[model samples]
Target: MILWFTIVQIAVACAAGLFCLIAGLIGRRPSDYTVGSLLLVELLLLAQVVIGIVAPLTGNPPTGDLLEFWVYLIAAVLLPIGGIAWALLERGRWSTVVLGVVAISLAIMLWRMQVIWTVQVA
Candidate 1:
């Protein structure tokens, strides 16, 4: 796991979470902007997955237990998938709520990844 990339993911997740909270407070739905941001985050995670796979192949120690790493990766990817699905099924404040869930889940997964990476390194 690249430290800077992980940091970036954390920052993005926080920003998305904040947006979700604000939208909820204002009683507004998630907009195109929210979806776009989620998509961007997903894309970044996909890139990270590719980099992670390549890194291990190049002789870097695997960042964590392979199964744990894969679980986190799948969860990260699934957040946006869930977000998109919910967005399609609901509108208004409910959409924002769905996004909030996605953001929080992403944050949790990223933190877990960090912890696992640390354990592996140690």
Candidate 2:
């Protein structure tokens, strides 16, 4: 729940989402670009997972409910996996759109997680 890392994650997710949405709107099917962007997002999430685990040990624990933070984090990690699987299996323009939607959704979820980690603790 590092503020700088969370901000980077949000920005990356939004950029990836916008890219996929634009590509889908242009009638592009799921390609390496679309999938790779999502993979990048997924990688960031994985890093976040690790950070979430180690941060508390390093004296940066969340102020909010720990369970709530973990739940949001777990869900955030899953979203990209689900989206990428759907895009690969379906291989359609709509699948790309779905990826975009997932990315945007992930960004929103990350925001909530940040709130729970910092703002809601008090």
Candidate 3:
């Protein structure tokens, strides 16, 4: 919900998404770079979870629908986990692409979360 951190998350997610997408398109399978990028995004999302908790306690509570924000945040966290699982199980270039798509989807979701946190009013 922090604006600057949300921007950072969006940037990182986009970069990771594009990186995985390019790697997949060039006939690459899931590798450390591709998988690690997703892990990095996951870490960021986890950090966001902590921030989401602490931020409200620190008096930066969201002005929007609290339940909607939480749902988006939870979904954002789950997305990368699912993508990584798919990549590991499938072990194919398309799996890498799926990871890319997941990352991109996560970026969009994060953006929506930001809106829900700051723009929408309960």
Candidate 4:
């Protein structure tokens, strides 16, 4: 439930999304650079996952529905992985577009996760 970490994750997702979208617009297929950039995001998400898991155990559970927060975290971790898998198989600019869409979705998921974490306890 660290707010700054979630904010950084959102920023990274949006930046990655824009990068992939620009690559698609320029007629470039998914490449090492795209995957590498996504890999960074994936790594950050892994850290987030670890944090999410540990926080609850250490007395910092989300203020809202913990189940929903976990679901969002799972989805956030999977999106980049699925996108990379698709790109590897498709090997086209369309794959880049797909990745861009996934990255944008990841951003939304991060935002949702933050909201879930910060909901007022009642």
Report lDDT (CA) for all predictions: 0.78, 0.93, 0.93, 0.88
lDDT of 2 by residue, 13-95 (tens): 99999999999989899999999999999999999999999999999889899999899999999999999999989988999
Candidate 3 on 1-122: residue-level lDDT in tens?
78999999999999999999999998899999999999999999999999999999999999898898889999899999999999999999999899899999999999999898888778
* After superposition, candidate 2 runs with Cα above 4 Å error: none
Instruction: Write the residue-wise lDDT of candidate 1 on 1-122 in tens digits.
Output: 77788889988887887787678668877788877777777887888788778877777656568788888888788878888788868877878867877887797788788778666754
The best-first sequence of candidates by lDDT reads 2, 3, 4, 1
lDDT (10s digit) by residue, model 4, range 38-74: 8888998999999998988998878888888888888
lDDT of 2 at 81: 93
Worst 10 residues of 3 by lDDT: 113-122
Clashing pairs in 3: none
Put the candidates in TM-score order, highest first: 3, 2, 4, 1
Misplaced by over 4 Å in model 4 are 120-122
Clashing residue pairs found in predicted model 2: none
lDDT score, candidate 3, position 80: 95
Report residue 71 deviation for candidate 3 (angstroms). Answer: 0.8
Candidate 3 positional error at 74, Å? 0.8
Q: Give stretches of model 3 more than 4 Å off.
A: none
How many residue pairs of model 1 clash at the backbone?
Answer: 0
RMSD of each: 1.8, 0.9, 0.7, 1.2
